[model samples]
Target: MGFCGGCAKALLIVFNFIFWLSGAAILGVGIWMIVDKNIGSYFEVLNLDTHDQFFKYAAYILIGLGVFVFLVGFCGCCGAIRGSKFLLGLYIFFLVLIFAGELCAGVLMIVYRVQIEDKIDDALESSIKKEYGESVTITDAWDVVQVQLDCCGGNGPNDYVDSKFVNKQSEQMIPLSCCVLTNKGTAEENPKDAIAKNGTACYDKLGEYYEKGCKDGLLDWGKEHTTILIGVGIGIACLEIFGIVFAICLCRQVDREDKY
Candidate 1:
């Protein structure tokens, strides 16, 4: 039995229309951003720091995804008008591919280790005082890590102690981070929800960058760490455009297939 020529067709047509429109929008934004100085950040994230290679890859992928989505939408529209089952089936296959690709990319992004090195270049004022006595000013913050437990907390820290979060790796390997942090330094990767870790000698610097305390520190970090935001925003856009393409294909398939 073929698809009932009412709800399914209507659904497909609606989604196809939306995706086609979105495809154009994505392409437009990507193109404008590529040219605009303001949009350079997105390119960097998409490329992962290589100005030339990443920029090209990011631009191509974004534009391709948008165009693919537009094609899917167009196919759906044509299939609906012509009632072509082959076009519909092809659309369905493309939908699966697009969805799988985006899902895989997201998973890989989270799991991949980039070996981030964070440094606070600004020195505390000479007169600044700490509880110990005077806030010691270290010229280089290379080893001076500002620690936090809630790596995956309500908000994240400059340092994501995914290392400290679980015995995940330590179950097999000796956790390099936890040993120093717990023994010599301050902070917990897997902090007790009820209790935040204690001890000042360990030098636990408490405070959120955005919503909580340490407004100045957070502000400083914010301005300095804007590059990260660039990568994240563009990567997200790539995933989203991929999704739009999938939706378009799915709509077309539903229009062509037999069965709801």
Candidate 2:
């Protein structure tokens, strides 16, 4: 029996409502995660209940809509099994509308979250140099250490003093980074801050050091997004495959004219 597209229209409409709402809700959550990151809710899983709302009151509506869509789609597919042209056509459309939106949003998120090291490095350098002096040295791990000549005094708060360090082993390393600011010398403050009130070159130089750590963290996030996108893609592909198989089987079956 030939499948008619008209019977499928209602199912397709419902499917869109389900998928669009689910996607929209998930998008809202993702947006929250990007900006605030403190909202604690996890209703956007990928199962039948994946579309449920976590903390959002409005999510209840979406969840209900999604449930209704899935049920209707399920019933339509069952009817399609007996070659009800209306049923077969509607179920096929339902699968396409529902899953397509979900897959696209997931893919886009993975792409947009990628991090570029150069951009991160530039920001680090700009912020760091604006704070420290030109002579600050950057450790390989991105630690910024301001170098001072043997304790030097100036008219103001930022006088650099020579720093001497004896490690737990009584080892001596006279790192210029040990420079001290004379105002209120507490061990909590880094000696670098006490350096001469110089230009941003110091912060910029120091920032290079900081960038290493920040960039590493950012790259890790980029990699994670990539992996998630890949996983989502694979899952959607699988679902589409199943949906297509069901659609094809329904199309070739004998026609059932009964309304029930």
Candidate 3:
């Protein structure tokens, strides 16, 4: 290979290795999203049978894209090392497809961002009012959210005033998840192991329950982490762009050598 070709090959190999690592990271994230009690519970409360499965759908997409990227990175690295035009071309095609998919996903996120927020708010409130204590999945979801976010109900402990969960109890009461825990971090870590600071029901002990609402708490959490997410996204985009350019340059160099 010529100097330019050799440089491109080396860069391509390095970029593809990074891409492969990223793919694995994405896959791990996807799996985490699926299994994580905290985040996964949020969508489970939406009840896929009746409500939008937005988060669940996103996790599945991530998994599929991650696998695709992993294989494409392998192809690109092999193609660059072997100086094979065919593999390089195939790698480029997959990159283009991934870029398009990302563009579409970004557009969809922009368009539905507000709508999703509103829907999630409504769905969560509805679940607390009607599904809590009735549906095991939704009950668990709310418990997890309340414990993890250090918040209560859709808005606050008051949100359960006329809720089915409260009405069903022998007397006015709120979920233990809404109470101040005896074990500070354990309940947040595992709701099933949650222990309230006192035996008193959260409904009667206004001072003991979390004043913050889950909705506001969730918004605050998102704000705190948004910057990290954005930075990672931009970094990935840059890497992909560089990978495409290097692949194309190397392809041309291979063609030039073959023509001679």
Candidate 4:
């Protein structure tokens, strides 16, 4: 029994160390998502104008959870090392709370999955009409999406034809980011010419640009990466469950020893 207790303590310490590192990684990712100007800006732009801060708030929430996890991990480590049942109990409570929250989130995601695409399209269309070129933030966000995904508008190149920004241009031009430059020079070097050969008209140069929209491009990317994401998510959840079980076992061992 003495040897069993020692082994449990060692396992708890090792698991807690891993949990601490995971928390740090989560915090780092959250901070990167929040501060890296172009990182998730495309998705952020899809939110309605009144809810523009949605992504920022979500990042903050993730950071908060990371901090909580980090602190709990530290508590668990100390409790296991010192044979303190109180700290282990506290860690168990926090683990349970986090597990419940994750389960709820997973359920909500499944419940809303069917409506998500329509909501995304509505938000993107609203953003284009209400705040596209009018705001520097919106314009930069869209530019990032177009350049990164090699996509044009929300649904396709034609989605921009009647947009305020394109209409305002004297020559009826989409953003240079939407164009695929065939010229050896940079896109800044007479962008219209860069997008097409000498005789190609702006509207007729459809082949020179991505016909697919950013929304579809992003959806396709998500579909491609879904398997990898699910694997990572499952791995993390399993680690958390293992940590919780270890903490509980350690606490029970401590209690039995104290009673004996």
Measured by lDDT, the strongest candidate is 3
Candidate 4 has an lDDT of 0.69
Candidate 3: minimum summed lDDT over ten consecutive residues — where? Answer: 43-52
Write down the RMSD of all candidates, one decimal each: 15.4, 15.1, 2.7, 3.9
Candidate order by decreasing lDDT: 3, 4, 1, 2
State the lDDT at 45 in candidate 3.
54
lDDT for each residue of candidate 3 in 1-260, tens digit (9 for 90 to 100): 99999999999999988998888877877788777666657656544332347666878888988898889999998999999999999999999888777766655654554564667677767888888999887888788888887888777677787789888985656888888888868777778898887647465755677877888766565444444544555677788999999999999999999999
The segments of candidate 2 whose C-alpha lies over 4 angstroms from its true place after superposition are 1-83, 98-118, 123-212, 256-260
lDDT of 1 by residue, 1-260 (tens): 23455545666677676667667765875576467542342122122233467656766786897799788777766765566766766666676666566566545443432212122111121111110011112101111222232111112222223323222332312112212233332323221212222323112333212222122333344345444534544454454455445445445555556455
**Relative to the true structure, how large is the alpha-carbon lDDT of every model?**
0.42, 0.39, 0.79, 0.69
lDDT accuracy of residue 217 in candidate 1 = 38
Superposed Cα deviation of residue 106, candidate 4 (Å): 3.5
Q: Report the candidate with higher TM-score, 1 versus 3.
A: 3
lDDT of 3: 0.79
Q: Provide the lDDT at 135 for model 2.
A: 20
Q: Can you write out model 4's per-residue Cα lDDT over 30-57, one digit (the tens) per residue?
A: 7976676655564556652323476577
Full ranking by TM-score: 3, 4, 1, 2
* Residue 2 C-alpha lDDT in model 1: 37
Structure candidate 3, residue pairs in collision: none
